[model samples]
Target: MGQVHQHVHIEWRGGTCRVKWWSGEYHANGRKRYESKGGFTDEDEAVTHGLDKLYEIRHGTHVSNRDGATLMTDWIDAWLGSLDHACTTERNYRSITNRHIRPFFARKTVSEVDVIAYRAFKKHMKRTLPSSYGNAVMILGMILDDAVPRLIKTSPVERTKRRGKYVKTHTRERKKDVAPETVERLARNAEILLGYQGYVLVWTMAVTGMRPGELYGLTRHYCYPFWPASDPQQDPKEADRYKDDKERYGRDGNRLPAIRVERQVQFGDGKREFFPPKYASYRTLVIPPFLAEMLARLLALHDYDWVFPARMGGCLGSANFSEDYWKSISDGCPERKGPRIRRPLPALPAVPDFKGKRMYLLRHGHKAWLDEDGHSRFAVESRMGHEVPGVEGTYSSVTVAMERAIMTTLQERWDVAAKDGWGTPNG
Candidate 1:
């Protein structure tokens, strides 16, 4: 720790009781010395006052001092390193956290990132990448939530929300994964011999409405058919899942079935690992009926390995998978001319040449179906693994069953749309 020394001398400035003293550092590396505020009535008074100011100066952390290499920056590294997530995810944190939030707030200790700075950050993010900006805000809030108490500083962005129009460009908004129909067809079109592996992957997301990260994070061990009997795995999850519940089981001390979702596949750092899910979905992904069966069957047959295995049968980098145009690997899809007909979508999609789109359109379609069916936004939002709009009782209102219902609706819509040609005009 640094030391402090305060010398007081009586002085007069504008006929006031002011003390002359020096605080903090006595000198810079250069010729500049410590500052002097002259004009004090008595030396004792000046000395006493100077000591307090010096204490505040030496011990009182300057807001500016909090800017360089603080706990906030440290926590991000710790958090990122601990992730079992895919490469894409790690890359995203590095790119977004380091490039955007860190450079801006890395200097600010957790407490230093107040609402004003948060708002300003949000505004800046909106200008660069609206969706990513919003995500950054959430990540920032999450990282700080655990850090504030530890750092003894307040988290500025906590409970803050952005309102009014989203600053996304229309063209940018249009450019994401194409509609779900295209994604479905893309899956079907891949036509790999692995028994609808591509189809099921796409279908599961459409049906279950789980996020891509959730799907990627899955391990063979996590999926099992929900047989109520005493299995080593299934029973423990239900008991421990609601461990957070005060009632544990509610009035009857019972929770519906519990599903697990502990990991995610992210396209980051040119590699992938199983990272924690973006939200609560990381721990559990509530599933609908057909989906439970489907997941179970897939797991049993594949031995709980990656639902989609690379040629190497190891963890596949999300970025590499996406980059390789392996979106649809079913036997059904045929490549004609040059392109494989369907490439994983990153741009606002146009109709594909050979009839199939990318894999994400299904997710998009499911979201649409959920919204149309009058499912509560919170319920739908939860399934999508996104923050719900408005600060309503979203945290409290939706039950696991309701979340399951949202998944059910998504699957139903996907099945209907798939048969109907992915809600596209195909005869």
Candidate 2:
């Protein structure tokens, strides 16, 4: 049972009615606790509120005001500490928390973050950080939902649904695809700008659909012909099976060469290190014969550990590579006059349909090529290192016929490009 009472102030100057207060008593862990709320004008209303509180406590749905008073910043810290995310994921979450969440809700308590406050935060995120708005909202929801009844009764963030239909706040833009001829043009332009290595880089990305980090981290040990045997990350059982099949020949034998995608280059805390590929999609990619030969030639020329080292040396960084290499390659570099120029550098022609486009478009182009070739969905998705959801992924596997068809199609494209006067580099 609970009690409702009104406290009258004799020294009051203005008010004729005294405010009523309500309180409920409960026991837990061999101790008695009190839950209360004040500032009701009617006695009956105060009593009803007290009874509701008592009912909630009895049904194990009571959320204490004291616990809800915990600051959002403190709760976020605790939540982040409890997570066991990967290094890159952890870094992203910490960055979003510090840059967006903590700054906006620094002074607010967990319980104070109601629907109104959440809506205000959403508008602020959309206005100031439109590009990161979705991610910020997701992170906030995760943090608040984890609080549950311990800090707050329920989360204010609700799913965007309208009349039983899910609503998307933003429309996703489809990735642009680069044509085979355009890929050739881009590779030639890269050669003109940064030499043969740049040409090879462009062609490899277009043909194989490798991510920039995976390409940058590609070492001689992981390249075609040397991989599987030299790949330290490969499972021992799989390596043994490969070795056993080395001398054996099937109807569709191991004609196509492969490169192992075991790791990717990651730059963090002012240093570079190798991390598993995105979503840990460690896989082997079968390459066309021409690409295998091109890689061999490139390796013969460079004794460096990395297949594609920076012009000065070491791994190619994203910022510098994008500015000094990809920008000039994708978008034509205008001939410039300089104090140190012995002769004027000629303006390079930009690749058609690639102006102001990202290098990732090449990966998308490769997938488009696969889909255009009428390859199986399972095989194409597997080649692109994407996991297909449900039973399809678990049961379906990339077959030897699929690999052969891919190799045949890619080789034909290269031969056609060569006939069109876009021959391989002499180096």
Candidate 3:
């Protein structure tokens, strides 16, 4: 309403009449915005429509035809910029949107994307990129949902697909969870190849259920030993860190030694940045006495802030760790010209048809162990840093008894590891 400008013009086209108009919009300290539309048969109609548009602009309900004609790729760029998601999520969304969504829909107008086009896109995704089909659709739906009231009147994403519908014939290869005994062998091989640090890393993951990033994010400051009220002597720092956990577990002091998961390190923009755990998966983890003792001894050996550091004294990047350390041990060191020639893999127990399983399998194995030990669904989910879902996830509380039971179950595994000479302090 600050300053309004308007213009109307007419043109004679091959025995036909055409009219065009422009509305110059400037309000307060904002930039002077201009809008124009052309190709109307009647000058009166063009003027009326232009005035209506100008009115809407002044009233703050303006819907721009130019916005409706916004290309999918441009809209996607804007949408991604507008979001405040974690860096990891931002990387993932960008990768998928650019790789899959853009090539097909980039040229189409937002207003022109109809159910027919959406159905074809969905069918194409199912036929060619079945594994990524669901995530692609989800990201598309999120964008369209935001666009509905602003740019487009309706979204073309199918209701069934949006609700997670899947065809009966399609299948995805599920990641296999290894047995706890197999994890022990993996740890033993890790020690032989990468030394004691590797051994402790794999063993801790198998029993503690900490995600890879969380494990890498661990610092000595976060590790806690059991400090029950019943015991008068305790590490002052451990007591301070476990204060909340102690109160939650009724201060009985019978709880297991624990580690606090405060942050995760992820890769982005050619560098690693520390971020909160994915999906806010922050929780305390309690370990058995043997692993706790080993960790304590390991901590005393170095003054590095990180509990597990790379060879050069910084956090271990997952990619470098996987390629240089994990793969060499799991398979064998690759052929080279010098002292780094190919080495034979140690004779670890073989699982038939095992196709180079990654380190994440240890986490899955830990969840399986908890399930096998008959822990409550709530306790298992809580320990795994997953929301339990429904009313139970909201109302349920993890009590001292549940934690003690989990501790006992993990202690049994440690006992087996001790006999196998896997998790000892000097390993």
Arranged by TM-score, best first: 2, 3, 1
- Listed in order, each prediction's TM-score against the native is 0.51, 0.82, 0.75
Model 1 compared with the native: what TM-score? 0.51
Ranking by lDDT: 2, 3, 1
Tell me the tens digit of each residue's lDDT in model 2 across 186-284.
888777665677788888998899999999999988886566455564467676656633432121355457777878987776688888898888776
* lDDT of predicted model 1: 0.54
Per-residue lDDT value at 178 in model 2: 67
lDDT of 3 by residue, 50-130 (tens): 777767656656657677888887888888889888887888888888898888897798887888888778789989999
Best by lDDT: 2
Pitting candidate 1 against candidate 3, the one with the higher TM-score is: 3
In candidate 3, which residue ranges exceed 4 Å CA deviation? 1-63, 123-131, 161-177, 225-242, 246-255, 328-354, 416-420, 425-427
Candidate models: Cα lDDT each: 0.54, 0.76, 0.71
Candidate 1 lDDT tens digits, 124-212 = 88788876866687777766665544453455654533576654433532434345565555555432322345455666666555666
Candidate 3 deviation (Cα RMSD): 6.2
- Lowest lDDT sum, 10 consecutive residues, model 3, at 225-234
Candidate 3, pairs of clashing residues: 228-253
